[model samples]
Target: MTQQNKIRICVAGATGWAASALCKAIIKTPDIELVAAISRSNAGKNLSEVLSLDTEKNIPIFATVEEALQVPSDVFFEYTSPVIAKHHILSALRAQRQVIVGTSGLTDEDYASIEAAAHDSGRGVLAVGNFAISVVLLNRFAEMAARYMPHWEIIDYASDKKVDSPSGSTLELVSRLAKVGQPITTIPIQDTKGYPETRGAAINHTQVHSVRLPGYIVSLEAIFGMESEKLILRHEAGSSAEPYVNGALLAIRKVQLVKGFRRGLDSVMD
Candidate 1:
């Protein structure tokens, strides 16, 4: 496609790990154009200088989403922190820009607000916690397993730098699983021993255990306790951010066809 026909993208958090990989991916993609790069810390610096792209061309970095949206784009990618993701996404939606959110700190209520904004503006938003296709399938299978085995717990592992406790993927998984059916409603919560905190946080009737430590990039496991056998569904990620690149690109492309809010990359997948 020609330059004018390419999908214009404005990336928030352009200097972060996932955004860094996404910027590189967009640089090589023929049908996408990097119109605006939003990074408060790297504001006024050239994208080539910050990301070290081979091209001598410089992409302007804006300090805020409001400033970045001034450039006009087809799609907005939210790769910023949880604190600012809702604001950035709402701004983009109110401006009638389709958005793909890669941020993980948002709650279900936050998404509900985003969905309402998108509905009012008649734009689209795709949000995913872990973008790898394997992770998506893992969440899908966990939902299926939740139906037959109603006694499952989710364990999410990530590096120390990860702010969210359960992680976005775990939250999504638990939310989906709860929809299949309430987990063993007959089991009484009062029967638990010791401190209640020992059992981990209860989300949508499922327990979610989070482990944050150094050396680990990211990992998620769904453990189902049964009478004679147990079923375990797990997904692990390496140090590099490459796993999320393809999924992010897919969301960017798919956002064009969708209206309102769609959660997970699996929603758009055939």
Candidate 2:
């Protein structure tokens, strides 16, 4: 492809684990150009310096998303925190740029607004909680099972430092599962006994439990119960961030062909 044909990409949270990995992938991909790296902490430094890549290419790092938008880019990749994910993505959409958001924590209402904005702006935003294909399949299968099974719960496992109670993947799974079936229990929360908190938060109609520990990288489990048997679907991730890279890249490429906000990596997988 010619220079003009390449996909120009800018990354928010360039210094983050997932964004840094994505930057390297963009650098190596022949069809994608890493145009800007946005990191407040390392704004003035070259991306190559911050990433410790051997390449001498001086990719300018911007401290803010507003500043980075001055340079044109086809896609804006977001790997930041939830605190700013909504603002960054909305800004990118208003700028008429396609976006891929890997950051989590936004509520369903936030996504509805984003979808409306994307529709008005005629841009696309693809957001996925866990980009690993396995997790995507796990979610899909659980959703399928939810059509038949009436009772299920989500268990999210992550490292202790993970701020979010239920990991993004678990939330995504629960949300999707909730859509397919009604809540298994009809009892009011006021009637529940002992520690109500132990029952976990309700997502859609399903209860989701979060477990954070030191050794765990991240894991999500969807447990379904029936009359005589129980079924469990789980996806676990190691310390490496490689699992997310491929799915994210796929979203970047697919977002160009989409309009409005889209959710789930499985949307593009098919």
Candidate 3:
């Protein structure tokens, strides 16, 4: 593709742990152009310098999404914290830019608002809780397992420093399984003999347990049980951010194909 025909993208957390890897990949990608970046600490600096890349492209960094939107980009990539993610996405839609969301911790209500904004603006918003292909398959497999098995629970594991509970992947899994069917609960939380909190939080009629530790990067497990047999499906992420780069790139490419909100990477994947 010619330089003028390339997909222009502005990434909100361009200097973050995962987004930095995506920014590097975007620079190397032939069909995508890194137009602008949003990083409060790295504002007024070039993205090439912040990422330490040997490229001649002059990608400016802005402290806010509103400032970055001034560069006339075609796509907005949100990888920042939950606190500002919704506001950034809405701002992007109002700015007439399609969006690909990589931030987690947004509730269903948050998505509803984004969906409405995208509809009014006639822009597409693809929100992915987890961008790893393995996690995508995990969600698909867990949905399939939910059809056969009636009892299941989710175990979410992440780094100790990560603030989000249950992880975004876990939330996505819960939402997916809810569409399949609500898991069978034999003992209601109210009827529990001991502390009801031990049963974990009930989200969308499914029990979810979150574990924050030092060793884990991000791991999700779905355990399904029927009378005598049990099936466990799990997806774990490594130390590197490479697993998410390709999936995110795909989202950036396909987000404009639709006019509303899409929830998963699998939504655009064949």
Candidate 4:
């Protein structure tokens, strides 16, 4: 594709572990262009310089999302922390740029506000908790199981360094299952004899347990049970960030096709 046909992108947290890999991919892709980046630590430097990417074009890096918005772009990729992810997304929408969100920890309240902003701005926002294809399949499969099975729970696993409990992928799964209906619990937490917390936290009316430890990148399990049978759907990610790059790229290309907010990669897969 020619330069005029390429999709311009500005990536927040461009120097982050996962975003950096995406930046490299963007530079190499024929139909996408990395126009600018946001990184407080590496601000005022070229993206190619910070990522050590060998490219002829000079991609400017800005310290703040406000500064990055001044540069013309088609999409703003939010890969920053939860504290500022919503703010950055709102700012991008207000700037009339489509958005692809990879940051986690946004609450339902946050999404409501984002949905309003996107509608007002007439732009689109695509939020994906985890961009791995297997995670997408897990979410779809879990939704189907929720319709047939009455009892279920979720287990979220991540590395110790990951601060978010009930990984974003698990939260997305919970949101999806909530549409089907709440899981049936034979014994309520309030009815438990003791140590009710051991049963796990209730999220969207489904019990969710989070485990943080070493030797795990990210993993999610949706367990469904009946009187004599049980079914488990699990998706695990490895150390590499490669799994997310393609999904993110697809979101960038398809986000403009939507007018408001959308969640999950599967929303655009079709």
Rank the candidate models, highest TM-score first: 3, 4, 1, 2
Model 1 weakest 10-residue run by lDDT: 182-191
- After TM-score superposition, what is the CA distance of residue 32 in candidate 3 from its true location, in Å? 0.2
Q: Under the 3 Å rule for N, CA and C atoms, how many clashes does model 2 have? A: 0
Candidate 3 lDDT, tens digit per residue, 70-90? 998999999999999999999
Superposed by TM-score, candidate 1 places the C-alpha of residue 43 at a distance from the truth, in angstroms, of 0.4
What Cα-based lDDT does every candidate model obtain? 0.88, 0.86, 0.93, 0.92
Candidate scoring better on TM-score of 1 and 4 = 4
Candidate 3: lDDT of 70?
A: 96
lDDT of 2 by residue, 1-270 (tens): 898989998899988987888788878887888888889999888999889865788889998899999889999988888889899999999999998988877788988899999999998988899889999989889988888888888889888988877777877777787678775765665578988888888878788888989999899888988889989999989888899888888888888888877788888766
For model 1 the TM-score comes to: 0.96
**Residue 240 of candidate 1: its Cα lDDT?**
88
Residue pairs whose backbone atoms clash in candidate 3: none
Give the alpha carbon lDDT tens digit for every residue of 165-201 in model 1: 8788888888788779766634566677667687788
Q: On TM-score, who's better, 1 or 2?
A: 1
| Models ranked on lDDT | 3, 4, 1, 2
Ten residues in a row with the worst lDDT in model 3? 49-58
Candidate that scores best on lDDT? 3
Give residue 228's error in model 4 in angstroms: 0.9
lDDT of 4 by residue, 119-222 (tens): 99998999899999999999999888888989999999999999878777888899999999989999888999979999999998999999999998899999
